[model samples]
Target chain A: MDLRAKLALLADAAKYDASCASSGTEKRDSRAGGLGSTEGMGICHAYAPDGRCVSLLKVLLTNSCIFDCAYCINRKSSDVRRARFTVEELVRLTLAFYRRNYIEGLFLSSGIIRSSDYTMEQLIRVARTLREEHGFLGYIHLKTIPDAAPELLAEAGRWADRLSINIELPQVRSLKELAPEKDLAGIHGAMGNLSGHIAEAKEARRTPTRAAPPRFAPAGQSTQMIVGADDSDDRHILGTSDALYKKFGLKRVYYSGFSPIPDASAKLPPAPPPLLREHRLYQADWLLRFYGFETQEILAGGEGGMLDLELDPKLAWALKHRALFPLDLNRASREALLRIPGLGARNVDRILAARRYSSVRLADLARLRVPLKKVSPFILAPDHRPARGQLDSAGLRRQLLAPSAFAQAAKPRQLALDV
Target chain B: MYSVTLESPADFAGWREAARGLLGAGIPPEAVSWHSPAEPAGLFAGPPPPDVPAQSAIPPVPRDFLEMAERAARHSDPERFALLYGLLWDARRAPGLLRTPTEPRMARLEAMARAVKRDAHKMHAFLRFREIDTPEGPRSVAWFEPEHHIVEAEAGFFQRRFAALRWSILTPRRCAHWDGAEIRFAEGARRADAPADDAAEDLWRTYFASIFNPARLKPDAMRAEMPKKYWKNLPEARIIPALMQGASGRVRAMLGQEPASQPQPPGPRRRRKD
Candidate 1:
């Protein structure tokens, strides 16, 4: 097939894996030789119709697979048109796109073609050519084949900024029933090996006895778990994520809501999960990572095991535990203030600083552009008293759930939120 | 009031020197009027303010304040200089003033710095380079219109990132060029100077259209991140409207289409048997 035809097929095949992050890699630039730079913040050059950031040239090497994972779009059994890009073609595409500032770099994944090691070797070769041949100093993310040889996995790490292995299903039973070819233990084993190497490389870089530290996936490893694909609820999915994070020291755990594909298998769900569920999961994930919320705390914010679709997880937690509301803004600690509905981490820091000089008032939060209505009932400022026990009202959740307020709050940075 | 003229729009060094002179001279922020060379001089414009030496005895501001002032200098706000200097002047009197977000002058200065930083970030994100074949070799060129006086301040980012390739980024206010080794600045150039498109754009547009999941179309979300203002220069943006128009139909077709025949069990060579 022609290059355009191949790209269309491959990108379509790869779209289901929603891991487009190109950040947290070691900062490198082309000043010395190559053709890119990554300084901390990953830039989203474009946004796709799905509200996903087009940061990297997220595509697969080929849509041909040996394994028949039922939920995957590129399963070998599926009759969708398949295409593969030669290594040279892949390299050229990356450079061409990089030259045009269309992407951060290449995010190359391939369905298991030939064998696991062989597919991994091909993925590594693309990265090697970019870094070694062309001296390209851009961000690269490689989806690792779990069963690939350890030496090949190590080599893959040397050339790429981040490496990932998909734990496709949350439950072992689901994996066995739907994707029999996948091994949960094998995936975990690879993740364990990667975590060790990543930690060692970081240590080497820190206490360098030699010229420079040997790089091994400097951005670390991440994994994706498909939501709404099986019988897994939010509790089970988050539990899996929490375990992976603790055990493997992962950089991120992406939650991709199962969307309908053109040639989906009979085994998959009839409809995708509500997109808001995916959004809520991301919010919960943030709370877990940044806001110091435990897994239990976040799960408590949800009903049974599912997150509340209407309210944000943080707000849900605050509403459920109304005793925590009306925390004195001036007297509250950073941790206490962080639990406030409208307060983001940035605003909390600002409040801490602003309060050091004088007592923080409602107008002060307004200047920081805090969502006043969402926060007003939960915080007690010098001039604001939450309408004298507003938190005690039974209709408080409904009052805060006003559609106009939610719309205004959600509109500003909804597109920028990434999983 | 003293009329101080800065060397350039994003001239943090010049602003720092002038601010030091004013501060050392005990001149209040209200007593000074700041202007860059880009601004038209009034008929009654006074002579440029006297410069202060580096060793001038101004009260020491916190390191964070100095850094924030540096960023705020790149803001397009005409009052940016005054705002920063006013904050600096306030910092000397009020202990822990820089930490106070509620302080009016400090908050405004922080806001200005944040805006300038955000503008620089957007420039980093949105600048789309088109390949142009020069006599020497292939050179990548991009045309960007930034919302702030950030072209010079943000040039180092491009220089560091695209140092290997020969590239030029032309903006309305100024232009930056990198030729593998050294980065040079020149006067602003017209948009016509940069190439409009590259050969790979068609393939890129193809990838963009295919990767977009029609089942989860959120044009509002897409527009929020890749704002409409940037759509003109983006190669893939031309297809967005058509894609949006065709999304519902495409999704309906997918939902309506019969499920594909499930693939048979794993092949004989596969490690794990289904």
Candidate 2:
């Protein structure tokens, strides 16, 4: 097939692995000698209609696989047209797209072709060529084959800015039922090895040494778990993510709501999960990582194991624990202030700074653009306080709930990441 | 009242020099008026700002205030200069004035600075280059329209990223060019100066169309980040309307079909290296 046709097939095959991050890497520029640059922040060059950031040229090497796993479009049983790109062709396409400012860099993955070791070598060759031959200094994210040789895995890390291996399903039972070829233990073993290398490289850079510390995936590794593909509850999903963060030191755990694909397997659910579920998972993940909330504390805000679709995870948690309301804005500790519904980390810092000069009041909150109607009931300020018994009233949740677009219609709406 | 005319609309250095003279002379902000070249002179324009005595000592402003003022000065707001000077004048009496973000005037200045920063970031993300044959070699060129005076400030980003390629970025207010060795600035040019199309954009559009999942269509989210203002110049944007129009049909096709039975694993799942 021609290059354009191949790109269409490969990109379509790769779209199911929803990760487009290009940030949190060592800073480099082309001023000294190279063709591209990467600041600390990742830039989204475009937004696809799926409401996803097109930060990288995400594509696969080939769509032909030796193994057959359900919930995948490129499984051996599926009759989709197959295609692959030569190493040189893939490298040229990356440079062309990078030069036109269409993408940050290449996010290369592939089906299990020939063998795991052979597949990994092909993926590494593309990255090594970009770094050594072209002097390209942009971001690169490689999908490491979990069963590849340790030597090949180490070589892959030297060239890639980040590495990833998808867990695919949250529960071990679900993984076995849907994708029999994937082993949970094997995936964790590979992640453990990668974590050691990343940590060792980081520690080496910290200490005094003349030679440059051995580079090994400076941006670290992340994983993705497909939601709605199996019968896994939010509690189970979050429990798995918490373990992954603590055990593997993952940078991110992307929750991709299973979407319909052509010729899908009968083992998976017929209908896709609500997009809001995916969005709520992201918010809860943020709270777990940045907002100092335990997984059980967040899960307590909802019935069963699922998050409340009508409200964000943070607001739900606050409504559940009403005894913590009406904290004094002027004298409250930073941790206490962070529990308020409408305050973000940045705004919390701003409030702390502003209060040092004078007492914070209702008018001051308005200048900072804090949602007064939402936060007033939770905070005690000089000029504003919740009415007597207002926080204890049963109708408070009804009053604070905005008209949800997701609740109004079955049609898909925007899934924003903000809390 | 003292009237001060700056060198240009986004001239932070000129504004700083003028403000320092007035501050050292003990002039109040209400008695001084600021003007950029774009604004017409007021009907009873006062004399130039008074000079400061060499012996007068000016209080040291916070480093954050200077950084914020430099960014805020690039905003298109006509009163930005006066607002910045007002805060700088107030800083003398209250050393913590700038730190109090809840203050109204300080909040306004901070909003202006945030707007300029967002504009610069969008410029860095949305600018696209197309290749054209030149007498020297193949050169890449792009056309952009910025909402603020950020072309000069953002030029270094392009120079550092594309240091090896000869490229030119033309905007309505200013243009920047890099020829592998150094960067040069020139006057504004029309859109006609830039190439209208490139051969690679077709492949890019195809990749864009295929990567988007139709079942999760959310045009509002896409428009929020990549707005309608940027659609005209983006090659992939031309196909967005068609993509959105056809999304429901494609989704219906997927949902309407019967689920296929799971495929059995092929012989010997793992193929050892020969």
Candidate 3:
């Protein structure tokens, strides 16, 4: 099939992997036609180091695979239609769409066919073609195959602006049980190899003779873990990710909710987890990574390893620790401001910047993009303060979680997380 | 349906007041964002307009002015932007924040954008050139583009940066392509020069496919975020039909529960994260 045909088939299949991002280079449309255009906000997203969001041309090289990982829809055992694309096909699609001012660059992954080395090599070739043959300075993200050879893995590094290896199932035992062919040790080994290359490349960048060291994927490496495919608790999942980040210099660890495919293992159950569970996990993840709250504190927000689906993790945390309430907005450190559910890191920065020139009031905080309705109970501003004794942790939890009289029995209760 | 009026000439202040009037009528901000790049060529003058007085006490001007000047250089429309700079950022201070939505904050942002455009045009005009030889032949290059004609004004962003490289900004609307030898214009009407309606538009098709996140596809919400007007210019816009056609299947998938008939081991009931 032609590049376009392959792209249509592969991209359609790949859309199921929702790690949408398209940023890295600041390259704008200076020439007559090139793909990198920053002029329009269009639809580019980037993940803040704390995992906000980033834009990239995220897609798969192919959906064809050799192994039947039960949790994966595209696994070999599944009946889902599959397709693969050549390196040139992806290069053409990425450059063409980019030139027409469509996206920032490519995010290519694949299901292993033939062998891990062969698949990884094909993915690497796409990046090389865009960079070397086309002088395509746009962002290139190649998903790393954890089982690929270490040397071929080195080539993956030389081309991609970012590399990611999905951790599949969270628990090692769950991974072993669900994906008989997959190995956690191999995944860790790939991550370790990427780290060594990136470090070496950084050092090489300093030497004039080292051909400029090609900036070795400045967006950095990231991984994704499929949640709910096993009984691994929230604590265990976060712990796995935390270890990945600290052990290897990973930029992100995405959570792909396990969407069970057909002909799946009998060991796997039928219904998917609540979408709210994934949302709660993201909120909890944000708390641990950015808000200085440990995984222990995040896990504390609910009844068990599960988080409260109704309230956001931060708000749930604040309810559990009422002593932290009425946090002085003026005196609170950056870390404290981040802990507030409604105030994002960007808003925190804006608040800090605004406060430098003038004293901030409750209204001013709102104008600065603070979610006043949510943060009100937790923070004290120059003009307004929450009634300190109004609600204890248990009292507030009851009030927050109570069924709103406005809701009909048939209608789903709208939670603060929804808004 | 609303759009910014640039067909007729108006200074930055005059434009701001008009936008505020429209904004008060409860219109979305997107309704009036697009306008002419900056002060139009017809508006150029020998001196500052009567309204402009002197520089303000504000510590520093926004970088937008410098950016505008660079764009103007590429277009080579210096006089228009010079007069715009003289009119918009004179010694006097800008108005304090609008007391209420009565003045429309988003409108003010656009008007300020217009002011920057005017000043940038002026800088684009005054940019000097240097020459160089390449396999392609001699070319003039200068590295400078700012919203204001800071090139002519006191800013000196030019001499410092362009001292080594031979490149020039072929400003936004107008051409400022520099061959190391001298700067030239790739002038004409703005044309994207797209394929002839059906000239093998596969890359765009694939690009549209790759960028569309099935997980986050919100039809009405997406249409709201990216208006229908801009779709014709994007490749992924074509996928909207297929997307809508598949919307029911998608909704089913998003809302569907785990398959029940399959037998499984007795462990923690594994819910699919779908």
Candidate 4:
């Protein structure tokens, strides 16, 4: 097949790699008059599991790798069809697709070949040519080789908007087991280098000087951790993410559940990790990062090593601590409102805003756009009051467990209709 | 990063002159960029503000701000040049120079007004309305919300969408209505008894449930992205309950079904067995 045909095959294949965000990067446009501009937010197209890469031209430098990671489809031992793009050919294709408005920018990843250093250099050259030669300011997220030289990694930061070095697995043992050829020390070194560079650049920008700061990676760096490939549970995964963020100063820690590769190694499992487990990890991760919940606090509630499969992490947390419910909606803090399972951040804002004009009751909540049914039981509102003292601790847990608890306990046949 | 500050001017003659002065004083022009209170409205900006008082009327003086895209070009990065040059530039401001208004200040004034009015704060301050059901009998109600009184802005959006419905949006600020008549604003938040929109609400609930992606539940992430402030006026805000599928077994099962509207959760765990 010609380049287009090869791109169709390879680009589509590459979409399986989630983590296609193009935010946090500077803008770039094609002087060649390519259709879209990256100087704006690069097209942040997410590949939603059933296989669609609709937004970006997510492609690989080459699918040919010299290392064999048991979980990776592109590992040297795998039998998948492979294609490689020359630096020039990749640029031409990017321009062609861009002119047609087919994509926003390039999300380029490659399997290591020739050598880690050689592969890293080739990737750097592609980004440099796109940026300097063409002034192509679209979002360029280059997958920096953790094993690449520090100078090359710094150069990668200069041209690309965001750089990601996949941690691959959570545990050091797993990294040694699944992909022994991959060096954990090398990975840590690259992450440290990026953190230093981004911090230095940002600090320079802060000085009250008229001169611009040296451009490093302005958008910052993030890393990915493959969930479920190892024996680690949700608690373990969340703990891992927290440590990485604290230590490496990452922008994000993407969780890519270990999807079942076509030809698996003897060391690999036959099935994909439970999709819901990955979903739960993301929730737990969010709660830890944004909700002010510590990792151990959330971990304490999970009876199984995993998060609650039926309910959200927050709700499950609430159910465990039923005494905290029946909070006063009229005077609850934003932090307190956030604790309620159904009352998201938005609901809290509405409640606070409306209460300023009127003493909020259950009815007022409905008016302010707060989900009273979800929040009402947990909170005491004016119009529709909660039967706070009536319920025993166990019953309260059941109520926090599900919004339809009373009706469900009263009538189990209504499950389909109730939902 | 001083993000979201609107920049005015595009290296106008005055800006170039300022650059020369700064350069003479040893400051590299590339060290820092300036952003004034310009409207985010692009080259094809919208119609000028119809309201706001005369303070903005004389129209802003025209020379645009200069952009600094490089830092290395400066000697010692910025220190060697800035210490001497920064002082000279600061002292160099012309005391009596009001200068002639070039392009017209109407655009800048309008831009600042719109920024304040449409900003997230205004969204919280404004927005008044009553609930109404849809033709399909779902309870959905809308209110008249504004950055300022743009009858056309609110009316244009509602006429086609809620033409046949009865909804009242009352603002401590301004009022809007579709009393089954021409879309127009009244004086304040309408009476609560303007007739309920039960069907619209039901439809909204269904629409909310239908469109909500189960795989997209990140309370902290969602909260950070769509701050807790603006939920007061939006019908979809109530749907946040429905967004938390894991909290309910039935909802969790529903999410597992991979509703055609969204995708099947493909996180490593959900991949199908061959």
The number of the candidate with the highest DockQ is 1
Clashing pairs in 2: none
What is the Å distance of residue A278 in model 3 from its true position?
2.3
Query: Which pairs of residues collide in model 1?
Result: A77-B263, A354-B101
The lDDT of each candidate is 0.82, 0.85, 0.55, 0.55
Every model's DockQ: 0.36, 0.36, 0.09, 0.02
Q: How many angstroms is residue B81 displaced in model 1 relative to the true structure, after the best TM-score fit?
A: 1.1
What's the i-RMS of each model? 11.5, 11.7, 14.0, 19.0
For each prediction in turn, the share of the native Cα contacts (below 8 Å between chains A and B) that it retains comes to 0.65, 0.63, 0.06, 0.01
Model 2, residue A110: distance off in Å is: 0.6
Better of 3 and 4 by DockQ: 3
**Residues B1-274 of candidate 4: C-alpha lDDT, one tens digit per residue:** 1111222222133333444433443443345333323224345443321223323212122232111111111111212222322322433453112221111222232233334334422332223233445674532234434433333243433343333445445554445565555656555465353443332333233322432333333344334223456555544456565456432343334334333232233122111100
Per-residue alpha-carbon lDDT of model 1 for A323-381, expressed as tens digits?
87799999999999888887988789888877777899998888887878899999888
Docking category of candidate 2: acceptable
Ranking by TM-score: 2, 1, 3, 4
Worst 10 residues of 2 chain A by lDDT: A410-419
Q: Tens digit of lDDT per residue, candidate 4, span A236-309?
A: 67877898889877877777766544556878654556555555666677677667788887876677667775
| Residue A188 accuracy (lDDT) in model 1 | 96
Global Cα lDDT for candidate 4: 0.55
